[model samples]
Target: MTDVSTSDETQVDVETASESESSSYDAAQRRSRQIEADLAGDAGRYRMLTGDRPTGRLHIGHYFGSLANRVRLQELGVDSWIVIADYQVITDRDGVGPIRERVLSLLVDYLAVGLDPARSTIFTHSAVPALNQLMLPFLSLVTDSELRRNPTVKSELAASQRPMSGLMLTYPVHQAADILFCKANVVPVGKDQLPHLEQTRVVARRFDETYGRGSLKAPVFPQPDALLSEAPNILGTDGTKMSKSRGNTIEIGMTADATAKIIKRAVTDSDRNITYDPQGRPEVANLLLLAALCTGRTPQSWADEIGDGGAGRLKAVVTEAVNSTFAPIRERRAELEADPGHLLRVLAEGNARANAVAEATLDEVREAMGMAYDLA
Candidate 1:
């Protein structure tokens, strides 16, 4: 008998090499398909669903993340829906009073930021009862163990010492309900959210396989592909995630003086030559990035313009840029705030349109699942 034994080191190297090759191949295939889809303009066949959780007033991070994308999508003539995710807020925080106010403030922010209510439907999660109802049937399709394995749920659980509630545990399922109810074919998502999109696709596939007939639309749901943005991640003044809780956010509603003060107090390195070194001087780089975004100038240009004056000149230029960018938004927000009734009317009209679409989707869902007779 011939003995052919490999050492553990060699075996490990072989496995690692195989995995890397496989990952590269898969990524290449995904890229090819994405390019094909883009060239074909297949996005036209799809409706888009994207939103924020409305945990607090909108920040620059929110603007960069999905809000700006939403505005562009709306302009592109894609059927778009922006949900103020009021329900999801409960998963992370307590008390609805603050959230309710925050939710309305978010609407004002959205309007001020140029989300035309005419072009896009802006509504709340709680207003869509049919959409919420779909959660029940969708939940039955997946296992508890599967929910536990979701990376987002796991991360949230790890962040806190408190026990995870049922709402928090199955938050992804609720998200699926949100997308599937709209039958949205494209969901603009960040890289971190790919897992949730995958899970939504799974629920759609399961529903089609289990109950869909040939006469009914097979897999009526489209596995939404991500529309990645080119915007840089705007960091908080403290160099953390730009959040209201951190007190580092430049609120869209702030006056010019307030905005200037925040920029002046923004964190930066002690020995700053105003270079854009995110790794070595994240705080300084972040400020520069904000200034660039506001002024419509490249960060490199800003760096050149403010060279060698240290943090003081950086602060001055940044404050000027930020004040200039937000001046219009502040004026518009104040105008909208003056007439609270107009905001309510916008929500009411949006709710009606959203309800009509959601109810139509729910009817089809019920018919597919043989529940139409029960409803009749």
Candidate 2:
């Protein structure tokens, strides 16, 4: 009877082990399916590389443009890379000192805005040397005329009074290098950036066609797709593009009083009635939009709620809303400011992880382009 009991116990142990293994496998499969569902919502595929040129502090426009989407993407378990384009800033501006400060400030802003460092990797463009090196061979894949014909380049040049530098001209190529180096399959971009992604795909195609030895091996380059963002265009207080240089943005980290003052000074029409007519009443409409965004209420609903209020009353309501919305962010920013070293460590750790990926990609790129071991 004792021998029989031992045999039964061993059988039970083996069955329990098998069940545990099965449970783990099922959990992994469910996790993968959840990721697939998230990607399917945005068309298909995973992994995203999106960023901002750290020219100044983040504002409402940045939040509406890509930062909000980033928050959602992080929750969805997507592998996200938020690049602080420190090097790319030189294409538009001439100084590095301000850019360095902006990068650190941007890091603080990102953290305060809920970009949990545990979920997302935030790193500087210049710190990733391997990504920069990929630009050399990538430059060879496209012609000068193609670069000049890029609509983004044309528009930026027309907008800027500064002389176009070589860096500015090849800005698209550097962006291509950033995307391709990570083998990122998706890039969340605005409509204005489609041309740059197109150039990136072109480079990927060129690289593959030039050196894809088909033998069941991984391709030299994986063509990335632009995941165009569907967020609304956030207008500045002046009813134009929100820009720091234009003095139109309301800084996300500003005090409530400062934010209220900015809203009070916002441009508006002489219309007495509070209506949401964007075309005819751009300024008034902008105020309504701001209020709606702040209160988490629809513009149409807010317009009806504040009926009969003139533009002055509408501005006051909008100011209150703006102040309330950013209050938590400002508070968080103050807390982070008290411990600047902690923020630096987060950035440093992120940079090290980013560089690991960048270095591996650069090795593959150099080997494919026959640039490896020349110095050896």
Candidate 3:
């Protein structure tokens, strides 16, 4: 019954695989360190451009994922451009009508979250039509296969179980335009969004290699580097990715009782005792994460405190933390929403500022491609 073999070949193979993984991990660490050094050295010199789709009100996942980084960068005096991707809403939902209110809501959220218009240029994608003109040249740099291979697009299509529209397929190119138009040198993204940023880099590089190589030593468009957020992603109540489409998301400015109700209803394991087992108890861990992020404490510490009472106590803490932190934000959002005209004026001024940058960049692109016959 004792038939066990430990051959040299198997041992060598195992060692080889382990060494390979170790080498890759080392390389990644080195890269991360380099980026940290570079940002620390001259962070204000960097121009950041990041934003959200105005499909719905921003949620907890949106806040923790990248929004917090945006605030930090703005405070550090990095020239930032916050875009509202209005066109993107129709890429998936063509039937959605009257997005103006949603756009206003998103703007209010941005303001409520301390995204100062004085420091950041907040504008809608539709306002900067010149940015779209850059997309044609950018699209020529990318291929149909590459677009289809984009993980973000592939995942969305898979989830929808529908053939992707051309607009949906070329959304990455549109993203490239968004980055390049503003001459954004940095973009804050998550692990999943790295591919999209890479595609933008490729397009920028290809354009430079093809056109800018002759006149300009480097590309006219800077290949934007990612400023990956250190904050952990927040999950939905049901242990899935928080999403607006699924109605599983807790909008940041929801009433305190509503927030508590949603947290109370969040799924957790049958175990009466609480422990920080992410794999075994994802839902409970998520609640703990929410509390920890809101309170600046450790998830395990929260789990340890809620040892006997189970998920209910954890939910209560998370609810209180979130509401307490977001109380001022909600009040600001309400104040802004009450005076919609004042919000529009702010957006209008931002649009003018964005258009100035976008048009200047477009003029450069047209000149680079020898399409600007009117250039004097």
Candidate 4:
């Protein structure tokens, strides 16, 4: 074989070839970004990401705070996504037997609340391997101090009553994966949840800065905006924050009898009159707020109608309104539960759709990072 050493002219051609490839890669990345920006402007096809943790069945707090907004957007033809963050459950719990049941129950709650599968996608965190894999790369994009300083994580850590685990520490990274996986741009959240979304934005911006226009960031995830809730702040029966763990919640899936029982036990003052004075009598006002929010009537109006009737009257009215408002949901939940096969099918199909989107995004990421090369 005749071997020819590289001459000056040949070396220049090789350098020119390298420059051309670099230019082509840069052009390709810019085109990808411009195309995504155009797609994002399609108002009719806007994407939203929101869902419940599988702590248990969602209550009215979930309804007014976030679920109602999700349903409205879904009906408006938006690409609504409901992520059942099942992996997040293990961050606080040492067991798993109950988690599967909670996931099923949460899915049932989603259906019962009118999250139609045809219009929206509902998938679990564990089902999409692509999402989990993303966290590994995304974790590097955020700092440890940033993760620890997150209020959401801190609150959960305190309530967990257990030492922080690695999973617990990097959960914000996991959350970024969830949002970025779908490339969701619209996020419905309450004021309390703003921090979580804010951290997601930080991670997205950091990832984009490191790899976006600057470095061909694949699947440039939108820095999601928080769609804040305009609904009234809902309080529990005991005049405290409404949560399932607090035992004061009126479950949306509960039968009228069960709902009535919980409302009857709700704390109220012995003022011998019904009033909406939250500062004067928070417990009594709490019941009025519940009924008002459920019925779309003012608490003062309720107090005016129930004058001198006391706690029994207020509780009875609230129980009636609460039961009536959610009666249809309760019925649907019963039907869905009886037909577990249908529920599983919906969830499985949603998981498939989610996996498709996530896998494609992951592939683009690999290709962008020059990691998709064939070793052979």
Instruction: For residues 192-274, write the lDDT of model 4, one tens digit per residue.
Output: 56667777888788777666655573437788776655666778877788887789898878889999888889989878778
User: Across residues 1-376, which tens digit of lDDT does each residue of candidate 1 receive?
Assistant: 1233457667888999779756744564475357336634654565788887877777766776667777777766777888889889888667565876787898898899888998778899999899898888899999998898798899888997889989999899999988888788777765567678778989988888877754385765666565544558888888888888789998888888988788888888878578888788888888888888877788888888788989999999888888887788889999998988999999898888889988888888888887787633
* Reference-based lDDT, each prediction: 0.80, 0.80, 0.84, 0.81
Predictions: Cα RMSD each: 4.1, 17.7, 5.3, 14.3
TM-score computed on alpha carbons, candidate 4: 0.85
Number of clashing residue pairs in every model? 0, 0, 0, 1
Pairs that collide in candidate 2 are none
Q: CA lDDT of 65 in candidate 2?
A: 70
- Which tens-of-lDDT digit does each residue in 129-204 have in candidate 3? 8998888888898888999889878887888867778889999999999899988988877556777888998999
Candidate 4: C-alpha lDDT: 0.81
Determine which window of 10 residues in candidate 2 has minimal summed lDDT. Answer: 27-36
| Model 1 Cα shift for residue 197 (angstroms) | 0.6
